[model samples]
Target: MTTQQLIDQIKIKKSFLTIGLDVDLEKIPHHLLTLEDPIFEFNKAIIDATHDLAVSYKPNTAFYEAYGIKGWMSLQKTIQYINLNYPEIFTIADAKRGDIGNTSSMYAKAFFEDLNFDSLTVAPYMGKDSVEPFLRFNNKHTIMLALTSNEGAFDFQTLNVSSASGSKELYKQVVETSQTWENSENLMYVVGATKAEYFAEIRKIIPDSFLLVPGVGTQGGSLSEVCKQGMNANVGLLINSSRAIIYASNGTDFAQKARIEALKMQQEMEEIMNLRFNV
Candidate 1:
């Protein structure tokens, strides 16, 4: 989907929520396990239940990779179902993949062309050559990792590095340098909600760019604070909530319970949008 299309959905839904489909077999309803493909079945139920309440759905690739071939098939079926049923909803392959230039291109093709994800999460540690390949695909966004939500982010991302403008956080340099690459307009970023205080400074560097924010709800990040600090004219944020929504229950009413959780966030997001942009 184009950036304008994504922005339009955010307005139409009055939400910037991205539901993470990080399905764990252990946590899913016991009844689902009897189905041939429990992971996909679980995802289908969740997607069907909360599709309207969210503008995007992200499936962290590691969840599928863990189950091997059957898991991969489940991942394929889940993405296909979403594309066929709700093509308007933005989809993300939450595969934080980055490699040498050639390898990156193949990875890009796998997710962008084959799976047909609207976006893919990419690690920037490999630098421009590794990321620019993914950015080459038209209308497909490469969401680079920036000030992430994890505790270990301070080990590298926040470390001061000498630059022409004097010392600055490594993440600041990454954001600054990325804009100079080809097709940089297609770039979005991963800015963890836990690091909400850093949003203002990050916004100064790339005010117009979209940010895929995780770490809310189960991770204890504040929705209101992230929106207040990170939002731009386009309401440039995709606040992701995974465990808190999808794992709301492990019974037959799991999908219904998931919607209730999603609805709470959607309503909260709608209120934020109304107050912020009067949409």
Candidate 2:
């Protein structure tokens, strides 16, 4: 989907909430285990329950990759279901993939060409060559990892770096330098919601670009803090919640429970967007 289309969807739904589909077989209810594809079954129910309230769905590849071919098959079915049933909803492959030139091309194809995801998360540590390949695709987005929510991110992303150009923090340099690779029209970014305070500085660098922010619900990142600092004229944020919404209930009412959790977030987002957009 184009950026405008995404904005339209968010407006239509009154939400920028992106539900993360990180399905874990072990944790899902025992009743669902009877289904041939329990993962997709659970996803279908969750999507069915929450589709009206959410504008995006992000599938983290690790959960599927762990089970080998079967898990992959579940992913394909789930993605297909989303495209067929809810084409308007933006889909993101949260693969965090970054590799050399040729390899990155194949990675791009695997998500954008083959699976038809609207966006894919990429690590920029390998530099432009690793990211430029993904940018070549038309209408598809390459979401670079800027400030992450992981505990280990402070190990490197927070370090002060004195480059050939000048002195800057590692994450800031990554955000500023990566903008030169491609146009913001096709590039979004992964800025963890936990880094809400830094959004003001990050937005100054790339004001118009959308940010795929994680760590909202489960990670204790305040939504109001992010909206206050991160929102632009267009409300440029996709705050994701995986465990908090998806695993809200383990019983048969799990899907309904998920919807309840998602609706709560959407309601808060709607209030924020209405006031932000009106003024």
Candidate 3:
């Protein structure tokens, strides 16, 4: 999906919530295991229950990769179901992949072409060459990691670096340098909501670029703070709540419980949009 189309969905739904389909077999309802493909069945129930409350659904690739071929097949079915049933909803392959240029291209093709995800998470540690290949895909967003929510982020992302103009943090360098690459407009970013204060500075660098924000709910990130610090004219934020929503309950009513959590976030987002943008 194009950036405009994503923004349009946010407006239509009065929400910019992205539900993370980071399914864990151990945490899912026990009854689902009786199904042939438990992972996909769990995902289908969650998607069916909460699709309207969210604008996007991100399935972290690690969850599928852990189960090997069957896991991958389940993931394929999940994405296919989303594309076929709710084409308007954005899909993200939360595969934080980055490698050499050629390898990166193949990864891009896997997610963008074969799986047909609208976006994919990419690590930027290997620099431009590792990320540019993913950006080259038209209408597909490459969400580069920036200031993350993890405590380890302080180990490097916040390190000061000297530049000709002055001194800036390493995360700032990544954000600024990425804009100079090919098909940079297709670039979005991953800015963890735990670092809500950083969003103000981040916006000064790339005010219009969309940010796929994780670390809400379970991570104790404040929704209101993130919205106040990160929201732009387009409401440029996709706040994700994974464990707190998807694992709300592990019983037969899991899907309904998931919807309740999702609905809470959606209601919060709607209130923020109404107050901030008068939408």
Best by lDDT: 1
Which stretches in model 2 have alpha-carbon errors above 4 Å?
none
- What would the per-residue lDDT of candidate 1 be over residues 90-133, giving only the tens digit for each residue? 99999999999999999999999999999999999989999999
- Best by the TM-score measure: 1
RMSD (Cα, Å) for all candidates, in order, is 0.7, 1.0, 0.8
Weakest 10 consecutive residues of candidate 3 by summed lDDT: 161-170
| TM-score per model over all chains | 0.99, 0.98, 0.98
* Models sorted by lDDT, best on top: 1, 3, 2
Superposed by TM-score, candidate 3 places the C-alpha of residue 172 at a distance from the truth, in angstroms, of 0.4
Displacement of residue 121 (Cα, Å) in model 3 is 0.5
Tens digits of lDDT, candidate 2, 30-62: 999998999999999999999999999999999
TM-score, ranked from best to worst: 1, 3, 2
Compared with the true structure, the alpha-carbon lDDT of candidate 2 equals: 0.92
| lDDT values, one for every candidate | 0.95, 0.92, 0.94
* Poorly placed runs, candidate 3 (over 4 Å): none
